[model samples]
Target: MAGAQRSEGVVTVVGSIHVDFFIRVPRLPRPGETIKGHGFAIKPGGKGANQAVGCGRLGLPTFMVGRLGRDFSELLLNNFRSNRVSTDYVYVDEETNTGVAFILLSDEGENMIAFDPGADYRLAPDDVKRAESVISRSSVLLTQLEVPLETVETALSLAKEKGVTTILNPAPARELPCSLLRRADVVTPNRVEAFMLTGVEVRDVKTAVEAGRKLLSMGAGSAVITMGGEGAVVVTSEDAYFVPAVRVKPVDTTGAGDAFNAGLAFGLAQGLPLVEAARLGCVIAALKVTKFGAQEGLPWREELEEYLRKGVLELTTPTRV
Candidate 1:
């Protein structure tokens, strides 16, 4: 199915959009310490936008449902258009400023980031209310925590009402109500986020299963704990298994998660099983970390299929986490 024509369902991304300012340094600065940067660059990013880009680049029909400031609307819309992501539901708030992220990247590929959500947080329930039809018709509804929790909850609730598959990538970890978790068909959280949600440290496969169990107990139908280089573990009532990360020389780890989530949604849209979808996600993420920019590194459908056909052969095997 990798090279098949896209006559599948649409993926709707309801999340954040930001202009990322990246400063490269020899290493992260200490408190009250100033360091010279090797170089600097700016790019378009945000969990939601990156995921939408990922979906589009993978040859999936995708839509972005979020808020943007008037100042950055053109830039963001152009990005969506280039990626083939429909921007029909993107709201523009004239009174608010565009969102931005200040990132400090070390030469070793480690990163520290801070965000000013600005208009991203201004996405109200009313905004989502206007896109109810879009949400209802979607095959997969993907979202993150960059937007207001209320907005996320509203989107999740609507997806549930429509019986759409809901995937929640709980990033920038925060405590959430069980009502929200229960509605999610799948919750994909990185190590830090897993710890924040389940109070379980996810250092290896065993602990990842434990954390996943906690998430299931909290009401998520399934849980995926992404452990970066350690690989990812998926836990559900039917089965538990690990999907190894595709190893590559790392350049930048930014946007890896976004790419992974999009890959997951794309796989599901193609009617792949849950664990297989996540394996496809791992394939996309491995490609993402080998490049510098977030969206720039996302693979087109042909590129991804070629790589999947040639490399990462062992993804067919799933070991118990």
Candidate 2:
């Protein structure tokens, strides 16, 4: 939770490491269409790695529990260490290859991505079992959907049994078993994920509430729905509030959501209420889109405090959408 205004506690990020290949194109090609690209860049990235860096920059003692291929193992390990995240629990394997993401961006920052999960898919229950002590003492556990579902289930199960607060960021939307929801203290899902989880289209706050209610019924303690450009909605059994976003020209939207999740986890780990955590996350994400790259864009604790101190607090009263 050190990423928010407060600087304290250990936050563990359990996920993947990926090398991203990006290209700027005139437009996304159709199934049979071919187009020329105008630019290219290879960046060190991965959602899990990005979140860990975000947490580390915010000043928390962070640890990453994941697997990487021999080719990129040392590079990814150094990435975490350079970011100040502990790499004692990270592992390298000879059989699997590191993950990769091929991304296409337009001049305006809108983009498309294709991914090869690689070693991420091979993470098993035993991988998590190896870090029981480090994870048990942590204030929070951060995870995403880039790896296998059973692996996620195992991590959540361990966190739940140990009574550490658990947060799940369900990205690249997928339908998860309802059983998994029981272990989550908070589930962060974007509009697309809300739709998939509840069988309802989330075009507005009211719709988000309906979808959130359905997810809570399925066993999650709370559901936070993030709406890009518009804002975010936090729904719990006790209350619901909508936080509007800062309107800014986005350079690239790649890691905005992950930055937001990092903020929320940091806030919650520090004992903030659900709505307050979401508010911190909203502002952090709004700041993230002003720059490019997932980890590069995340604001440090002082920067975030300055943003708020500069009287940038603007909360819109939401009516439906």
lDDT of 1 by residue, 1-321 (tens): 222222356888999998888999898899899999967998999999999999999988898988888777898889999999999989889998888999898888878899999889998878888888777777888999999999999999988888788999998799888889998999999999999999999888999999999999999989988888656899998889999888788788889889889889999887888898988888898889889878888999998988978857475357865
lDDT of 2 by residue, 75-188 (tens): 788878888889887778789898889988877888788999898888778998898887888888999999888888899989877777889888779898889988898998
The TM-scores of all predictions, comma-separated, are 0.96, 0.93
Error of 1 at 302 (Å): 1.1
Against the true structure, whose lDDT is highest? 1
Q: Which stretches of candidate 1 lie over 4 Å from their true place?
A: 1-7, 313-316
Give the range of the ten consecutive residues with the poorest summed lDDT in model 1. 1-10
lDDT of 1: 0.88
Backbone clashes counted, model 1: 0
